[model samples]
Target: MKQKIESKIQVKWKACNHGLKPQACQHWLKIYFADKKVDELEKAISKAARDPAKYGIDQPALERRFKWTRTTMTQVVEYTLQAVVGTA
Candidate 1:
C-alpha cells in the first residue's frame, strides 16, 4: 500500500506543472502521511520533537534544513498529525 502510494505520488509529482514547489510538496506530503502506517512515524516524530536526543534526531540539522526553530517544527508536526488523522 505504501509503495503504491509512493508510486502514485511520484507519478503525480512528475506530471505536476509547478515542479517541486512548496504547495506541490505539501500536497504530496499530506497524501503520504495520511497512510495508517505513517501514524506510528508521526507519533514518534511528535515525541522526538520533545526529546530529540532520545529519538536520535539531529535537531540542529533539521532546523537548518527547515529554517524553523524546534518549537515551530514541533507545532508543524503536531498540526500535520492532526490534519492527517482528521482531527484538525
Candidate 2:
C-alpha cells in the first residue's frame, strides 16, 4: 500500500537534505542522517520498527511520515543503520 507523510512530520523532517519530497520510509530516513543526528534517529527508528506494537507508535503515522511500503520499510531502515554503523 502507498503511504503518505504527515504534515507535522514533514515540517519537522524538512531540515534534512532530501527536500521533503515524497519518499519511502527508507528514503526519508536517509535524510535524517544527512542533516541531523543519524544515530539518534536510528535508535528511534530501530525501536519503532522492532516491536512497533509495543511501542504504541502508529504505523500509519510512520507511513505518512515516510510514504513507505510497510513490508520493506523496517528492513531498509535497519539495513541503512547497519551500513552506517557497520554491519557485524
Candidate 3:
C-alpha cells in the first residue's frame, strides 16, 4: 500500500489601507527575511516603523500605524497558520 500527502495554502487580506494592513506589512517583511523567525519579523517591522522609506513605505505617517509589537506579529502568525490549517 502507498499513501500520499499534500497541502495547499491561501491567504486573503481585508480591503483596508489600500490592502496595506499589518498582515500585508508582515508579508512584505517576509519577502526580505524569508527564512527568519518571528523575532526577526518583529525587528524588521520595528525598523520599518522608524525608517519607512527603507521599506518602501511611501506614506511616512502609515509606518507608525502598523501594530509592530512582537505580540501582534505572533498573533498574526498564529492566525495565519490557523487559517491555512482550517482550509486544509
Which prediction has more favorable lDDT, 1 or 3? 1
Winner by lDDT between candidate 3 and candidate 2: 2
Taking all chains together, the TM-score of candidate 2 against the true structure is 0.28
Better of 1 and 2 by TM-score: 1
Point to the candidate with the largest lDDT.
1
Q: In order, what lDDT does every prediction score?
A: 0.55, 0.49, 0.47
lDDT of 1 by residue, 1-88 (tens): 4354456666656645555567756675665554433455555566777877876779775455344344454555555455434521
Give lDDT for model 3.
0.47
Per-candidate TM-score against the hidden true structure? 0.29, 0.28, 0.29
lDDT of 2 by residue, 3-68 (tens): 222232354455344543445434546644443453455557667867878878777776654443
Cα lDDT tens digits, model 3, 1-88, are: 0011111121232222355467655653453243246557667666776777777775544444444444555565565565445534
**C-alpha RMSD of each candidate structure in angstroms:** 10.7, 13.9, 13.5
Instruction: Flag regions of model 1 displaced more than 4 Å.
Output: 18-26, 33-88
